[model samples]
Target: MFSLKKSQMFALIISSLIVGYTTTMINAKADSGYTVVKRMTGNNANVAYHLANNSKNTYLWNGIHTKAKANLRKYKNYSWRYYGKSLILSHNSKKSLYYYIQGITPNGNEASKIRGIVWHSYLTPGINPNYKQLNNIYYRYFNTDSEYLHYVQKSPSQKLTREVLKLFPNTHLSIQLTKAADGASPWAWASPRVDGYKNILEFPTVQKYFNKRFYKPNISDNTRFKLIKAGLDKSYSQTKRNALTQYQIGIYYYNNPHRLIDDEAPGFTIAIPE
Candidate 1:
């Protein structure tokens, strides 16, 4: 039997502790330095729109994914809630910056709330181009803007239209629909294309909200004929006038939360039934 002095025992215990610590840290996420996400305060963007400059459709993910997850939406109005300064680390090989956002739907009820991670370039902060332009003029038909939606005026008169264009010169400031609750998705109002986004039915939000009967795919088809229609789903400017449609139509899905500037409308993702 081997016996150790008091000092020898202490040295042996210290060595054992160091070895255990090293073993525990082998696959630790923080120690690996893969995802360097630092929780930050005071998010940079309060309101943002999902508009891809190069790509046709913008997608909002359920989480930080290295590969495309089955659950992804083309877009959701008012779904992007900035989660502070988001950066890319070694874990994400794409080397692109991602923003943390929370998505809400249908008047922002708690039932419709969801958190998402999105690409930085896909989201443009403040005033969707469909409503107001970044460097261009923003025409206001009414004297005062609504508290929910900023920089928007409903029912621009013919005379006001001319005046606005004349003032801005080459900037087309138009009154766009910001729909909430329910609205018609007219083909004329949106550019309908089914090239890339066909997997929307697989998204988890469909099950999360639809299972609760919060709001189903109510506006795609009414007749049992199984109509597959796609268009620009628009909500009229006036909150009351923007009628909600339970009928079915072709549409692209989107997710965002900070778009209180408008009722929420128009996206590039399409939805289908499972």
Candidate 2:
């Protein structure tokens, strides 16, 4: 055993406490259960693409494709260690297939991208999209805007609907639940699809209290701040942070379960599992 001076022992204890505090403050998450990702490279893209296609009922991953600016392989870096389910778009042809790739980076979470047509041989199968709870969370909060979520009015109807209507002339807004097309069940619509619509939909206190661009918001602010921070900080990329902020805000709505406005306009609908 080594002997330490009193000052040295104190310093060592301080260092340990600092490390412990840092570890506790870090926004670490449990494994999200998205396990099918393969480490990919230029050399293996062809194999991976083919494998993914053969495995699942692939869909366009429209959300990612909409953001992919150009060819994914050319523009973005792919990681082997951290990847989510690779997807094949609906429109596959003889020569090429479109893919919504779950690109990985040095950061923890996978990044979504749209890779334009590539040789079918490159596609590699991974997680079944149907089984991807991570993707479903992404789809429900981001892709579908919490499409069928129900909300009760928290504050008196401030006519938030009329306010949004003035901005979006073609849009209709309400909080009523309508019978499904098949009339088998009822669905509620309250989420918005347009750009910058969230700010309008939010209660003034909630929106102002958790502004991301202007000020730093954290759990100390309340559960609302905690959820929002957790959602945005969950991703490293700024773009991803913004996209995920919407999902976090959705969580806030879920916990609060009250809305200033309701969803009556039907742009699209899907049955999301709770």
Candidate 3:
């Protein structure tokens, strides 16, 4: 039998309530696993993903990270309608929520229509509006790094809205450039990454740019294209290049606001939509 004083009993009850609340939150976030999914507009994309990898391929799979069914790059600019969502367990037992979607065209070529699964991130409408290459920023990379562009941005404020940021990958950003001169102010750098794209695609008002390798704007304006910064283009050491080339998509992200491997990497901000 268990017994407790009045104060002790009150404390015990408080602890139990806290634990229950935490468990509810945790359970709410747990993956809901199912194969078939319902169709939804929110999961849809107004434009197709850019296949910016050296391979120039954006693959859709038979299932979550499963067999490749088709390449969306062939149908560039096409819109996608989302079917639903499903949590899939990879070989490592990691859960990746994938969108089951199909490409649409005005022609409606049923036979040529592409249908498959892809990460929701891949279906972003397009690059962030704020991401653009600066004329004076330093270009950081080798000829081998053509798959993705890298650069450094120096600014007193890291409050990013529609502003473009150039983050580097594989190498340490500090070695390539000097730190804040007088005192530390927010700065950011962009480079390719080995993991899934770290840029929070859903981040409100954050800007992005199209990787020239896989992106061609619907319009003929060359100004929309992202260009390499004006200085420095040295090849990385063999080890660094190997790691940076892990994914064909070339996940480029930032090197500041250090915390979890998140959009906070360099200059991504949490701004309210106007």
* Model 3 per-residue lDDT tens digits across residues 1-274: 2555877898999999999988855553343443433333344232323333313556677753435666676665344555544344444445455666665442222233578776665665422112132211111221123211322232212212112322223322221122111011123324222222242122211223222222332422223322221111223233433353222221222222112122122222211112
RMSD (Cα, Å) for all candidates, in order, is 19.6, 19.6, 21.7
Give the per-residue lDDT of model 2 (tens digit) for 81-162: 2123233333222222333344432221333444332323445443222221111111121212223222112212212322
Best model number under TM-score: 1
- Tell me the lDDT of model 2 at 161: 20
Predict model 1's lDDT versus the native.
0.33
C-alpha lDDT of all candidate models, in order = 0.33, 0.29, 0.35
State every prediction's TM-score relative to the real structure: 0.31, 0.23, 0.26
lDDT of 1 by residue, 131-162 (tens): 32221112221122231123323222122222
Q: How far out, in Å, is residue 183 in model 3?
A: 60
